[model samples]
Target: MDDSIVFHGPLGELYSQVKAGKIKTALQGSHTRPCKFWTAMKILSGIKNAVVITHGPGGCAYGVKQAYKLTNCRNSGAPYEPVVSTNMDETKIVYGGEKELRSAIREVDGKYQPAVIFVATSCAAGIIGDNVDAIVDKARPEIKAEIMPIHCEGFAGEYRSGFDLVFRQIVKLMDRPTPERQRQLARSVNIVGSKLGPERTEVDTDVKELVRLIEGMGARIHSIIAGNCTLEEIKQAASVAVNCTLCLDIGYAIGTEMRDAFGTPLNSTILPYGIAATEKWLRGAAVHLGMEREAELLIQREYAAIKAELDEARRHLEGKRAIVEGHDAVKALSIAHMLESDFKMRPVIFNFHPWSTEARQTSIDYLLETGLDPEVLITKGTLKFGKYESMQQTERELLEYLGGVDPASTVYFGSSLSFPPVPLVDLNAILNRPRFGYRGALKVAKCIKTALDYAARPRSWLTKQIVFPPNSGGLSSAQSLTSKLAQNLPDCTVYAQRRKGRCMMN
Candidate 1:
């Protein structure tokens, strides 16, 4: 194995230890998929009385509900029952919870009469030997409406792995063959690999663009795998001639399975992240479908439009530096590539949790190809919530390791805000923004340009010694200082407010 092909960060360390010699690289923790949540939200939003049952322990169910709420689905006052297993206690774990789960499902089914009910399992359910599949099998005959069993156990693998498991379950339920048992439409394709919901306008935009792109190639979308898809639309997936798998992690499994089960060929490609990558991805898919000419024309149009927008952004961000931290290694790598290749900017570091050898290898390859050193990347920082004292000891150790770099140089991603003074970027915002495809790339480039320009504007408190008083009204003194310094600069408000504290921006 080439050593240069492996990139190690905090999460990668655990993965490397776990896999040992078995695998080359891995990703750490589970990265949430935006499309899956969006799909579920879209379905729930449409149905007046729908219930989403997470068939696992408290934490797993909590994560799912939290993801839903974070995506801004709950604010709509949607009539949906977000239920979880209350009986998932020791007894339920030791023996088996099939009876309890079945009862829970039936009760929710009867009470809600939901258009669709989704039962998702967790790591505990998987480890304790719960037969979720059998439970779904037994309950299917009795349920009046569609009861989709999603096997998204956290222990099943990583976030992408969970997506694959859940998506496969959805595919199994939806892709039943037509009576004629024929591929009904040659011009139709199934769009796969969105784990987040349509609540994010960007996700909605991407799906729509995909539909337009496919349709422009004289191919219609038979069904989108999950993003903004309904129960009925999912059932129509079998009619498609091909499955276009984007977001490689989530789509690979389902696409391959659909190809095998329905004879629908799978077109696997990296997601369109930047202008060039987007065009390449679109062209690749179109070529596979024998629509290269049409794809080229569409690409030319998008490329020209995006170039004009990016040119303006590049003027502002040309030589700036940035750091990115997220679980999606592919997206991170692609962003780094875009920063260098398109914007002529420098990405000082791109952090990821290593979980799989393949993930590590892929990221390493991307960084190497882009001429980035793996050493500059930092990963494995302590993620916690609550008072600063809890992280005091770890913070000291981290500060020592970080050395010359200012403490504020660190970037925080997740919900927890326990860390000491660090410039935080809400991971949700980074992932949710319309930052995919041609137009998306230009929009993101502009956003990055704005961020870099803001960063360069001199601020009083660059040191991490500035502390935020608990619930100090709006902006803290540090924030005020930063804001005052950057007030004269254009687009500096975003940075000024963001640097003040770890407030959720987006």
Candidate 2:
């Protein structure tokens, strides 16, 4: 609930009611949860000798590569290879490119004898009607290692769709593993819900802390799903006693399926984002595993350490407003609660898209319990302000419509978008820098302090002078004269000049 959470225009008015403690519920419905990218990152972190090969054009491979690199998993020593399908021209798309796909597979296998290869399809390949599964099926028998086809075409749906498809394919591969190998010395647990790119330092640290709490309760983590899971570890997942799913998307499904198939129980919970929620999640897991005493002790220690930092963050950010945007609604909700509870920030508005039932319920429960106004909750594509038509057009629009509006005190938490004039405090970067745990909380506190300090600084003349350039009408001397005049006369109206010159002020 930082100062930046308020929305303007029609949505802004509704948010004001919510901020004033009015209770209202708008459209409430169920939605499917998408895979959390952090879960994928976690799997990638634990894996060794496993390679993730994206099947599609160069952009597909590049996106995956960038995601991996951003997560800092590259230094973790996991074998991830991004493979682009042959550049298909119009003929290939219209006719078919099975031959080219087969060749791409053969060439990749020859070069990197990866224990397992995940071939993720691209939007182009998907439209071309290529049977990626068929190609992988034919090549699987010939290859020395496992070749899994992931139907993660860009245009397949949302990121959630890609996660679901990838996980389903992974589940299929899990069923076909070689005979059970000798169990490693320590008992294992599968950590699900990591995505490619920089680790969510706050969430990751929290997860690790949760793992420690579990360990204190006499449980051990076998392997993390996508974060650090290698092909070999994934195949051997049967050995784990349980799968702890943190993120709702890929992790929950993978955990539930693994439980059914391998007889491993699945524990689903909102990832630990704040002190209260973190303790609740830890206790829930402990009780499920019959480790109440240990859970108590672990919570005691974690809370003691976290309380000081939470107090500090609250002192600095309390009563401030903020906007939270991300793929993981659960994470966003948890963040909202933390801001409201610990930092005393008021959540003026919550904007998200492709809602899921569970996510909606969680948000609803929190709002109801807190007596939050329903009008402040806007569920649609990313928040837009009515500028930049292209942003409004994208399927996964971030901040397309954000323009001139003051949040008094604001903080923007999420990935970067073309719109939204305000700067973004990339959650991915923040998470990666200080990831989840007691230390992570401290790190977040520091980040909050920095952001608050920066936000409080007086605006400079240079900052105010920056503006979007006028489109069309050619750069006229009159336009230059108008700009110069406007700069000198703070209250000068440029609209009249722009209209006189027939300039398009985009």
Candidate 3:
């Protein structure tokens, strides 16, 4: 109801907001977001030859499987085994679904013959007090596949906690090494924080780019924690010299646990978006294994290759204002770092919820390490609705915000769903594919240069007609679908746009 900009300030000020209960004020509903069961399924199903037996209603099982497993089939480049479920219903909820769960787990293992079977509880199972661990304990010895029971009851509401839980469960799978084996693992490092694989984190190209850097330093990756790794590799991950967490938010919890569990030192910061972050990231990993010299040489080589591209892009982007949104606080800040520190642009990050930022403190810790501080904005759209409506509102809000500012000099750097009166930079463009290390800096420079070049021209006339309101100032002179929706014809506007292929996902 209160559709206004919620807050804006530096990172420290955002922290103050968190302390002041702004985050609590924003996140006030139980069903506001998907529960941890869905998140846990997403992580577990990413594992190679893994099966997840959901102990919940058919709806819960289907929703999570369709969203996490079935959809990711293409993204992961590996077909998923069906997500099995106990199919708990109203009758089972009143009694207990333990019988159905035990049968589901055994049936999944026998039919799929997977390497691991993760028996996960849904909110329904938690509500009904199904003893999932007891069922798993009874069934583990009899099952052919390695079986683990993950308790999802305590982490019902928040989805992020699921990532933390699954990764910690993975820590239980590692085999402790003798002191000699630990010494042998000096050049071996494990990459933590990735989902069961590459689909959830950075794209495939980005992951490979990070791998290139590590191998360049002559350090062997023991394994990526569940990211294209085998169960055997996970068991070997503990003996590694260090754990390099690609994402601190998801990785920090497991990283610290591994450090405490195996005495494997954790590099808590390795986001590596810009030159500084990448250099720092490489140094952080290399220093632990005494490979700093090799890292420095590789850095020099990377700098030599990227310097010209970086300089040329900086020439065009310096002093330009950038608006970044769509990503979480961690990733958005990393992008801001790339735009400001690497390209000499002023950055404004938007839509990063205070709760998510506060909960993922390690990202903020890295920003502090670099002393890279920037302004952050929170639009009313962020707290107002789900993805689809928030996108529409955010676009209108972006247009309004740009109309009030220097639209010509400002650029939006986020989702392509937005059509603000400025240069558009599609983050997922192929030119920006491997946006991770030194080479990625080159790709990013090219991406921005292309965007700025495109902005110099008038927008596609079709885009103007469909997105901007008729007679709008600065950019266009046409009534858009957004303007039509402002008059309460959302259904008609959406249908018309869909007919024209303007609203459909590519």
Candidate 4:
């Protein structure tokens, strides 16, 4: 029942609230939000030998199937994981769809002969109370492949809830490692909670490059949790000596669970996004595996190559204002710190998810220690894409915190989903580009430069009028001007308008 979104709060206050366990927010629009269905698709998308079955309507399943196509596993020579659905209709909802789900599983197995079959239920499936557990048990004897039912109902929680559920099931379903396997892979590590393939391979180079970095440290990547992992790889996950979470949102639970269940230590360091974070992660990971020297050498080489580029980009980025938002406060704080320390950009706001997790206190402590206190906003599970008024409120609050800032110079570094209503220096959708390590640091610098450069470009007088809107209190009256424009400009098309406290925009 705790509020999901919080605006106009200090970093310290937000941290205190999170620590005191007063910051839980329920997600809205189960169907629209990235629920368990989406999480299952993302995790199973990279597995070469798996078929995912969503026990839902055809429409629900189609979305996941379409998303699976976006993955760039072309180089891996792995066939796309088939995502099917039961296509639950009104009749199925009223009278249990257990038979339909069973049929889907059988069809997938007959067609694919996959090593494993993952079944994720939908909100409708959950409501009807299909005996999924009983079906899985009964079908195990009938089917040759391992049939694992992921108990991630759409309404169970948010995207993260599905992530956690999938990981837990993975631990239970994956074959337990033998003593020999454990010893043989003791020095190896698991990179938990990363995309299995190059979906954003064009813009996000960090995943592949991180694998290369780990291999350079004399450590093999034992498993990447659910992303791009086969049944065999997931089974061997228990053998690894340590688990490293790339991002706080997805892998924290997986790493923690692995440590608790299999005695694997977890490296819950903030993901290696910046030069400093990468060095720290590499050093820490290397020390744990007794490969510090190799890690240091690789870090030195990578840093040297990107230093000049980073410096040159920094010259253009200095004094620029930015706002960083993410699903986890820890990750957002890390980006904020990197922007301030490396690029010398001023972070006006730091928005994060509104949940109090085990890592919340640690993240808060680190933020306090760094002294880079920006206005903190908790996104109350409003996951729909495009700008929202709550986000604009945060921007206004940030403007208040800083007394005022050049709106044109400000940038946002995060996902396009739920970004502020302004020009954002977005890095989320850029495919295959590195956002971590020395090379990633250069990319960040270049992105800042590009955003600023683009902002500096001349615009029409009307455009400038819209961007700067005379004496409208920066962000406060933006909606007002937009409404007025809609009313007065009869000849011009009005794309979006606020009506009855709701946004009517296409």
Q: Provide TM-scores for the models.
A: 0.67, 0.65, 0.85, 0.76
Best by TM-score: 3
Top-down TM-score ranking: 3, 4, 1, 2
Q: What lDDT would each prediction earn against the true structure? A: 0.54, 0.51, 0.72, 0.65
Give the alpha carbon lDDT tens digit for every residue of 1-506 in model 2. 12334333233344345546552433222222223332232243234455555444555455545655433544444334543446666777788778887887787778877777666556677787788888888998898877776565555554454555455556665633233432441244566765543334434455566567667667677666665456666677755545666664457667777667766666665555655555665665665456778778876777687677567666877766666653455666666655565566665434543233233453445444554332243433333322211223221222333434453366665432222334334444442333354555555555555555544333233322332223422212232333343334321111222233221211
**lDDT for model 2, on a 0 to 1 scale?**
0.51
Question: Which candidate should be chosen as best, given lDDT against the real structure?
Answer: 3
Candidate 1 lDDT over residue span 1-506, tens digit each: 11222243433343445467543233223333333333343333222334667666676556556655334455443334565554477888888788888888888888878767877666667678788778878898898877776655554554345455656666666656675534456556777876544443434456666676677667677666665467776766766656787666567777877777776677765566666566656765676567788888877776786777678867766665545443356666666666666666655433344442354454454445445443234333322222221233333433444455543233322212223234333323443335667766766765554443443433333333343344443223443444342323222122344355321222
- The positional error of residue 144 in candidate 1, measured at the CA in angstroms, is 2.3
Sort the candidates on lDDT, descending order: 3, 4, 1, 2
lDDT of 4 by residue, 73-167 (tens): 55444566667888999999899899988888788889889998888888888888888989988888898799988777777776656666777
Q: Give candidate 3 misplaced runs (Cα > 4 Å).
A: 1-4, 22-25, 28-31, 76-79, 196-204, 386-393, 404-408, 461-506
| Per-candidate clashes, comma-separated | 30, 70, 4, 15
Error of 1 at 350 (Å): 3.7
**Model 2 TM-score (2 dp):** 0.65
lDDT of 2 at 155: 54
- Summing lDDT over every window of 10 consecutive residues in candidate 4, give the lowest-scoring window: 497-506
